[model samples]
Each structure stands twice: as C-alpha cells, then as structure tokens.
Target: MIRPFAALLALAALFSAPVLAAPAADAAATPSWSIAIHGGAGTLQRKNMTAEEEKAYRAALAAALDAGAKVLAEGGEALDAVEAAIVLLEDDPRFNAGRGAVFTWEGTNELDASIMDGRTRAAGAVAGVTTVRNPIRLARSVMDDGRHVFLSGAGAERFASQRGLEPAGPEWFATERRRRQLETMKAERVGALDVEFKFGTVGAVARDQAGHLAAGTSTGGMTGKRWGRIGDAPVIGAGTWADDRSCAVSATGWGEFFIRAGVAQAICDRVRLAGEGVQQAADTVIGEVAAMGGDGGVIVVSAEGETVYSFNTAGMYRGRADSTGTREVAIFAGD
Candidate 1:
C-alpha cells in the first residue's frame, strides 16, 4: 500500500507541476505553416471543364504550389513565396489573370494587383496598368521602395518600365476565350459579370522557409467589366491583406461589395479583436459578406498555421499544400 501511495505521489508530482504550453516553438522551427492558391471563383461548371482541361488546371495549380513551396523550402520569406507562387499563375494562360486577363469595355486590357506584408503592414497596388506583365512583382517593388501605397494607369506603367520590367503589348492580353466572353457580355448588355454568371481569380498565401506569412492576389477583373472597374485585387484590405499577428487573406468574387466591406481586413480584424479562430473568423466574415449581397470566396491562413477556404458561392477554385506535403485542390464545396 505504501509503495502504491509513493507511486501515486510521484505521478501527481509529474502531472501537477504545471506543464507550460510547449514553450511556444520558434516560428522558424515548427513546420506549422502552409500555402494555398486560387485560380478564381465563379460558377464553374463541371460540364464546361473537360477532363483534359481539368487535368491541365490541376497541373497548373500543382506547379504554382511547388513554385511557392520551393521558396519556402529555401527559407525564403513568406512574402517572397507568395509573390513567386502568384507569378506562376499570372504567367499561365489557364487563369483569367496576368497573361490571359480579360478585356475592358473599350476593348483594352486593364490589370490590377496588390500585395501585403504581414510583418510590416506595408502594401502596394496598381490599377488600370496595361503593360506590366507581372503586376504582383511590380506591387512588391512599390511596397519595398516608395512610401506610395497605390499607383494607376500610364503612370504605373511608366514606373514599372523604369524599373526595367518587361512591357507586353495590349495584344498580349487578348485570349480567344476572353474575346468570345466579351462578345457574350455585349450581347447580354450587362455590367461586370451578370449575377447569373461567374468568374474566378488566382491568389496565394504562403509561409516561407522562415515561417513568415504573406499573401497575394492576381486577377483580370471580370470577363466584361466596365468603367475602370477594379475588383478586390487592387484593394489592400478588400482583396488582399496580411499580418504576422493575425493571418493572410485573398478574396475573389463580387469585388464591389467586397470593397465596400473591406473583406480581407474584416476577417483579420475579427480574429485579432474578437479572438475567433481562423475557421470561425473566416466563416463569420464570409457569412456577413454574403449577407451583404456579396458572392465569392476567400483563401485565409492564420498565424497558428490554420487554413480556411470559405465561400458562399457554389464553388471556389482553391489549392493548398502544407509542410507535410499534403496537397488538396477543390472547385466544389464538397468532394
């Protein structure tokens, strides 16, 4: 009986001596970070996506994830990884951004992109720029260099050109599908994408090899947008925002309401001020955004390494890859 009592006391000492919460591991040491990207969010019809097209999309998404993962693996900062990953998508014609961006109403290509650094709260954006091939890179350059948070139109192009950035002609932005889409919109005579129609963009949120967090978004706006229409992509808090203290967010869908609601920043605020977990904050914000008549989705990653793909629409084109090499791609909310 004494022996048992002695053993119980030993166990009690082991259990009761206040175990500190695993000394909050160094952000660099814990393989507790991940990255996710989206091609866009819209009413994607499986019927419209042939197996070949779907396969191509999967490959493109995988390539983007790997590109970012490479940066992370090399101990690059999360912002660098996010930019690298998004550049791949921007270059890919499969997505409706960058090289294959949709056309503006006057039969021109206007591009917008924004980037945020969670650690510093520094951000950069460009709107209506027609020449810069990689808007995300240019945005990073703006953030790193000047005090300016945004640039627009020809001035933005000139700034990019001065930096020795490659300049592509307006024709380079044209894609047969987009041209046809423009025609379709003209026939329908609607503004932006009709509520009946849908579209998506490509984005990425990354934690680099050093465990720093960053997020980026790239889009061609909508297929037939008008009047200097800029979606969430160019709005710092609406389209993209990141902070090491909260999380990184990139949104897609009805850019108008998203802009009105400050979608991405709203989510971060909910988590930071309300103490909501990543998923809960994302769900609540997304729900509220949808209730406000906004339709679309968001890709969010929290500081504790949580990821959420939240949307009110039927589907969102999203992909995620983690330190464990676990990768997931989904269009539909289920399966």
Candidate 2:
C-alpha cells in the first residue's frame, strides 16, 4: 500500500507526463503546412464593387481556402490541395477560369492550365484546350501520363478524352457576362493584353505536412484574344513552378511579361540560390515585371513553411490559411 504522500506524488507524475510532452506532441501535429491562393490581379477597386459582389467574392475565396485547408489538415499532399482549390475556382462562375471563362475574339472559350510538383520537378500543361471540364485536371493527367509536358488545342482535348477526363461543350463554358465582355472588347478593339480584362486567372500554391510543395494556375486566356493565344497560365516556368529546394509559385498577370521575366522560376531561384526569403523573392520578381510595364501578382509557399503574396495591381483576389492559425481572405489593394 502506498502512503498518502506517495500516492499524491504518483498522480502528480501521471498528470505531469502529458504536460511535459505537450510541446513535442503539439509541434508534431502542427507541421507548418501552409497555402496561398489567388483568383486574379488587376484593376479591381473597392468602389467599383457593389457590397453584394464583394460579399460573393469573399464567400468564394473563403470556400476555396477551406477546401485546401481541409486537405492539408487531413494529411493530404500539396498537389492534391492545390488541385482541389483550383478545381473549385474553375467551377465557380464568378472567376475567369472555367465556367466563367472569358471569350476570345472569335467568341470561343479556350482554357489553359498547368501544374507542377516540387518533389520531382514533374510538370504538365495544356493550352487552348476546349471541351475539357477542368483544364487543371487535364494538366495533371498530362503529368501523370508522363508522355509529354505540354499539349495544345485539339491534341490536348484528344488526350483528355483518352484519359477519361470530363468533357464540356464550348457553349457550356460560355457565360453571358464573358460574352458581353468579349463584345465590349471587340467594340473597343482591345488585344490580348491583360489590361482590358482584370487579369483574371486562378492559381494556388501549397506546402503539405509531408514537406512537399506544389503549384497550379488556370486561365481562360484573355478577353478578345486571337489566333489561339496561350497565356502564362499554361507555361510552367512562367505562371506555375515548384521546387522543393525553394518554393512553389502561381501567378496571375500579363502573360507576356511573366514569360519574359520567367516570374515563377525566378522567384524560386532567388529563394534557393540567393537565399532570399520567400516574400522578398516574390516582391523583387513582381517589381521587375512592373518595371517592365506589366501588372500582376503571385501567391507562393516556400518549403520552409513561409507563405507570401505579392502584386503590382490595384487589387488581387487572394486567401491564405496555415497550421499556425493564420487565416485570411481579401480583395482590393488595402485589404
């Protein structure tokens, strides 16, 4: 039999065990998985948006953030999280990626998307793909198929069919808002420049609990685009890039300037080789794009669990969430 003092000591030790181990257990459970996402970046001003419109956008952004956060919290991979978020945005009519995609000058919807895995540097993209329900999925199929890194036009659609991807007719993707925008742009004779249409694209970047990184971008090309133009969204190093040694990046902006500046890869290169922090790299690269007379923004997740957002536009539709208890969803420059 134990004495009263000894019994109290034993109980004390038992209670103290969890308390002593709490820090390690908590640290293990919270692996600093983080994510950042963007709908687009361009001439979005708060005054231009009605309260109802702003609320709708915020709801959509929050929903996407929750989707990706659920994946990360449930121990899913970064690639899955990125894809899940973009897939939701693609289906939503409010953004300019899939169902709500802008029409070309010919009034057809041609989607483009790209995905990258930092683990193996495996990347895939599809440009000018019509009839793909979700271009992001098609891009992933390309990566998983391993036969090619990029596919375009009817060929990509054929590959999508062969891979059993969901299909949609061109009309299914054409929304009245986008058609009106196309008509307006045509009346104005606007070109493929992103300035005409608010730089509308959707993208995500994530660092998972397993320490893997991934990035993806999807777009409807540009309003009034002609000749089967493909934006940076389908260009791996331009709009989407991921590397475990540095970070994952997804950009929305002027595709030509992003391609010329190598925006995505340059950010990672600065982080990996120049030892710059993720935010610094993002800011520097985006600044260069601005200096080159382009406007846009980026969402990034570094392998070290840093998340960043950098843009040179009036507004960017963006959100972020992480294991560290950070959560945000915002639009407009000051938000």
lDDT of each: 0.76, 0.85
- 10 residues in a row with least lDDT, candidate 2: 16-25
- What's the TM-score of every candidate structure? 0.88, 0.89
Residue 226 in candidate 2, Cα distance off native in Å: 0.6
Question: Mind giving the per-residue lDDT tens digits that candidate 2 earns over 172-203?
Answer: 79888888787766665544432243788999
- The CA-based lDDT of model 2 is what? 0.85
lDDT of 1 by residue, 136-166 (tens): 9888888887679899898888889888888
* Model 2: residues with Cα > 4 Å off, grouped in runs: 1-31, 191-197
Best by lDDT: 2
Measured by TM-score, how close is model 1 to the native structure? 0.88
